[model samples]
Target: MRKKVLDVAEEAFQARGYHASSMGDLMATAGVTGGALHHHFATKKALALAVIEERVAAAVEETWIAPVRMAPSAREGVRSVFAAVAAELERQGFVRGCPLNNLAHELSLADPDFRIALAGIFSAWRQAIADKISADQRAGRELGTDPQRFAALAVASYSGAMSMAKTAQDASVLRDCLMGLEQGVMSSKAGTRRRSRILHRAL
Candidate 1:
């Protein structure tokens, strides 16, 4: 029953803003009594926090962290992850924006707890990307750019592209953004290699 309530609430909160999705709506959608809902989540805020910590955070881990961690190259991992997300957006007709970003935009300003929770998720995500970049740099796959900065750029660009796609109702925005980002990464890496070669030749 708890899981059911959470599932229903997560869908409701993601589709509608957290404030707009009332407990009555969630109870009706879940087909559970008010008592049952309270037994699971005493407050809507508690439910929202749970959704962020469990569902949204897990989604991020699966979609971004796990794939990048397992990939052979950070460049390929980042490119492939974005491409996959873009393809999924196209498959779904670009209706829903990112769930975490949706909640962040809606609730981050209204509540301090929500702000902290979303910031934690974003921090974890950024760290994962940064870790991948650092690994690639150590392996001589990426250029000399700061891993943290590159990770921040990748996350910011992806989030902005998602917002643009949702606004335009077109998935191509994601594809184009990712393609341009990947191209820039590859170009920067090449430039770094060229500079290294020049220095080596001068020695």
Candidate 2:
């Protein structure tokens, strides 16, 4: 029952925005009575916190960690992460932006805890990318830029692009972002190879 309430709360927060979603709204959506809600979550903020935690866990699992684990190579896996996000946006017709981002934009100002929790999620995501890029670099896979900086930039750009796509109601913005990202990755690979050759010649 607690899990069910959290699930409904997450969807409600995503759809209605944190400020606009009330405890009453959550109870109605979850099909649980007021007693059950109060028993599990004493306050709306408590429920909201739970929702944020659950969302962060899910996003990490489904988007960041899962893709890297499933891909044949780290570089290819990073690209596929962007590709999967694009596919999801296209499928949803650009109606929904990222849930964590949405909450960050809407409720972070009001709740410091919310901000901290969401920031942790974002940091984890960025670190996941960085770790993958670093692995690829150590393995002699050419990624053109500094692995840490490139990973940070990629995650930032992807998030911003998703936001722009949602605002513009155009899935093409996401597609274009992915294309540009792909180009960046390719260029980085080339640069790595060039540097390797230069070092070889000097040796």
Candidate 3:
């Protein structure tokens, strides 16, 4: 029952801003009574936090971390990650932007707890990408690359693209951002390959 409430809340919060979504609203959507809601969550804030901790965090992990973890190359992994997500947004018609970012923009400024929760997710995401880039750098696959900077750039770029797509009601905004990112990464890789060829010829 707790999980069911949370599932309903997640959808509602994403569709309707958290501030606008009341417990009464959720009760109606979830088909639960007031007693049932209070039984699991003492307050609306508690329920919202749980939604962030569970549903939103899990989405980030599945969308970003898992893909990076399973990739054969960190560079290609990052590119493919963006590609896959952009394709998904396009398929969905870009009507819905990122849930985490949506909530962050809506609630981050109104409360400290919400800010902290969203910031933690962003930190974890940035670290995951940075770690992958660092590993590639160590392996000489991305020599001279600043992992931290690149990770920040990637996150910023994606977040900004999502916002633009949402505002324009066009998935093409995300697709363009993903394409630019992929081109930059592939170009860097190609430069590395050309350098290797030159070094080999010199030797």
Candidate 4:
């Protein structure tokens, strides 16, 4: 029952935005009475927090953490992560932007706890990408820029693209953004190799 409530809350939060969604809405959607909702989550804010946590966990698991766990190489896994997100957006017709991002934009200012929770999720996401970049470096894959910075940029760009796509109601914007990002990463890697070779020759 708790899990059902959380699941319903996640969908509602994603669709309606955090501030716009009420506990009553959640209760109605989840088919639970007020008493049952109170038994599980004492207040709307508490339920929102739970929804944020669940969305963060699910996003991390689906995008970065789980793919890395299953794939042969961290780099490939990271690619798969972004690809999966793009695929989802395409399938859903850009109706739902990222849940964590949407919630953060809506409720973070109103709720400090919400900001902190979302920040943790974003930090974990950036760190996972950075870890993948580090793994690529260890495997002799050249990344043209600082791995940590590039990782952060990639996550930011992807999220921003999703937001823009949702705003424009055009999925092609996301496709173009991701394609450009991938090309930039590749070009940067090439530049890094060229600089390395030149420095080695000078040495």
Tens-place lDDT per residue, model 1, 1-203, is 88998899889888887999999999999999999889888999999999999999998899888888888876677778888998887777745888889999999999999999999999999999899988888877665777888788888888888888888888888778987887887788689889999999999
Q: Model 2, clash count?
A: 1
What are the lDDT scores of the predictions, listed in order?
A: 0.87, 0.78, 0.85, 0.77
Winner by lDDT between candidate 3 and candidate 1 = 1
lDDT by residue (tens digit), candidate 3, 1-203: 89999999999898887988999989998899999999999999999999999999999999887788778766676778777777777777656778889999998998999999999999998888889888877777667566887777788878888788888887677668877877886687688789989999999
Worst 10 residues of 1 by lDDT: 137-146
Off by over 4 Å in 4: 72-75, 143-145, 194-203
Each candidate structure's TM-score, on Cα atoms with residue i matched to residue i, is: 0.91, 0.86, 0.87, 0.86
What is the model-wide C-alpha lDDT for candidate 3? 0.85
**Number of clashes recorded per candidate:** 0, 1, 0, 0
Candidate 1 or 4, higher lDDT? 1
Off by over 4 Å in 1: 187-203
For model 3, where is the 10-residue window of minimal lDDT? Answer: 137-146
lDDT of 4: 0.77
Cα deviation in Å at residue 21, candidate 2?
Answer: 0.4
Whole-model lDDT, model 2:
0.78
